[model samples]
Target: MRLSNTLLALGLTAVEATQFWHNTGTKSGWDAYTHEHKGTVDEVTDQVYKGSTALRMTQIHDSSYSGRYHSEAVKFNAYKKGDTGFYGFAFRLQDNWQFSPAQGYNLAQFITDFSDLNCGEDYMPSTMVWIDGDQLATRVKYGEVCPTDQQKIKSFDGLKKVTAGVWHRVEIQASWKSDNTGFFKLWYDGEKVVEAYNLPTNVGDGRPFQFRVGLYANAWHDHGYEGTQGTRQVWYDQIAAGDAFADAAPDKW
Candidate 1:
């Protein structure tokens, strides 16, 4: 919803995003959605952050299977080169979530397709927010999107504590620059955890990137699933994004 000058001052308004918001009560808000084999996406009322419903994303481990696990909702054109914005959401891990210090569980990411190149990763992700065990981690990807592009990945880990079974907030503000002039920052549970600046924040490929959230058991596909908790679930609510921090702040808007 674009807030008019009056609304911007009065803190009221209309439309979609200059502002965008989703209660995760239904599938109607996302630009695209997916749930791979054995993974399920549902709207339930058992737990919520702000509204009556929340999205439940679940993935089950397959010891004998070799496919990736993902149940996600995508917001297309979330950002591109030179665009600056704020994105935020509320999430909760299942009560019995098992944390493996050696493995990672990705929660959100910004990505774009580079199939036109055909020499490197097809769908390259620019920035990703995740948890390695109970600690928060994030990173930036830059350089040309090609086979010999250096694949520069600058990672920032051990940012914050991620607790299970309770609702937590996440907010990211980024300047989408493919050169060493961009900045990226993250806030966890209302606390500023990561502050980065003057760094290349994306690939040389200037394609529009999609913002995706939910459960992506990427480690299972790359490092193999860990422990016995084969089936894992996560809940998300109060998803939002826009040009200003308050427009996307989970608690503000």
Candidate 2:
């Protein structure tokens, strides 16, 4: 069993937190936390990790416009600089997913809209988790908050290939900071894949960032579609964010 599931089975509650929050992706839960959601976002019973239902996000190939295929849920003011917290969720990619080479499918991200300033930076995402082909990848962007020229992205790729039709857990602990005092760590199914210390993890400004999880077919926009599967879908459950691992871990709640 995965560590999160193990914890739940053992009924462990050691970790403490400022807030213990969990979203089962029910109708009320989905409606309360998301806004400006595009494409198809629904609660389905076809597949679920812990609860009776899960959030299913679907995106189809849109040839009319060259925008992103985003069907993600957002939680505004989720975190800010100097805050150390854990965020986690359980997800499963669709079976028979086309694991084409060089195609990217975004899973979760932490971003905010900075378009009102009009300083060359619009909607910028600081951290993102995605799948490149069959392998899992994630990236962290730091330095200036605005303008692409002022940003620096550090990416960690080729962690592990995901298994379609099976549920997986992802947990992240981040110390949000713009200077060299922050740290970032990620655990996939209880194994630590990436750990970096004393690095810039967020924009220089102390603005709050939103945390979101869903399917964003970026390859369609960046490199155009390259696979037979044009439609994509993913399921998410036990979405949480808090200061302790138990607070965010799916099974722990």
Candidate 3:
């Protein structure tokens, strides 16, 4: 009986070691999602994005995965052409990221794509702070649909350029300003890219919109949209919801 118990202990230790070896580089610390998404595993990457027990995305279909994380940062279309929601994260979107057309309420998003044409639009009352490969800039638009034609509420060009392949912090803070007014702000690498302010009239107060994060890959008008077609890998951790929008730091862990 003692021999059998010893063998079981050894087996358990071996399993743990194997798990640690696989997660060594990619994992920094445990996020609340790790425990909430306990059993689900990604079949592609074998990584998991677990949520807190109380706030699990289990209710949303196609919300979770059981494979490896995305290989390339691609375009994400969580809301349908007419759907609306809120989402925020710090990530790297290679030049290849693509944005879908603004059909109804659709907003195409691309990070790290510094070119003026490539940077897509967020919803009205939304703010995006992005570091182009060359410099840092914030895109704040106030209207629904593509706001490229509208005046930019705020723009910053003095920010430093964001290096590729390196991890940088980015975040978006959105709140309701009034029954039909919305406010949003953006930050890059702990610096404010856009200040707090009101959103566009068309967006009609951002209060009701929830947030979603994912990757999307779609063909672009020009075959030149090569980067937009492929999958891009992204790592997301320490996602939270509250009034105060702060970046996650090692000290906080």
Q: Pick the candidate with the highest TM-score.
A: 1
RMSD of 3: 15.5
Instruction: Report how far off residue 106 is in candidate 1 (Å).
Output: 0.4
The C-alpha stretches of model 1 lying farther than 4 A from their native spots are: 1-17, 20-25
TM-score on alpha carbons, each prediction: 0.91, 0.89, 0.40
Better of 1 and 2 by lDDT: 1
lDDT of each: 0.81, 0.79, 0.31
Model 1: per-residue lDDT, tens digit, 50-79?
Answer: 868888999988888898888988877677
lDDT of 2: 0.79
All candidates: CA RMSD (Å): 4.3, 6.0, 15.5
Clash counts per candidate, in order, are 4, 0, 25
Worst 10 residues of 1 by lDDT: 6-15
- 1-253 per-residue lDDT for model 2 (tens digits): 0123332332222334343345776544332233122468788999999869898988888677677788887665667777788889999999988799879999999988888878987878889999988998998888885566888999999998888989999998898888899899998988899999999888887777778888888888889988788778999998887777777877777
Model 3, runs deviating above 4 Å: 1-88, 92-160, 178-182, 196-202, 205-207, 217-231, 246-253
Q: State residue 236's C-alpha deviation in candidate 2, in Å.
A: 0.2
Stretches of candidate 2 exceeding 4 Å from the true structure: 1-17, 30-38
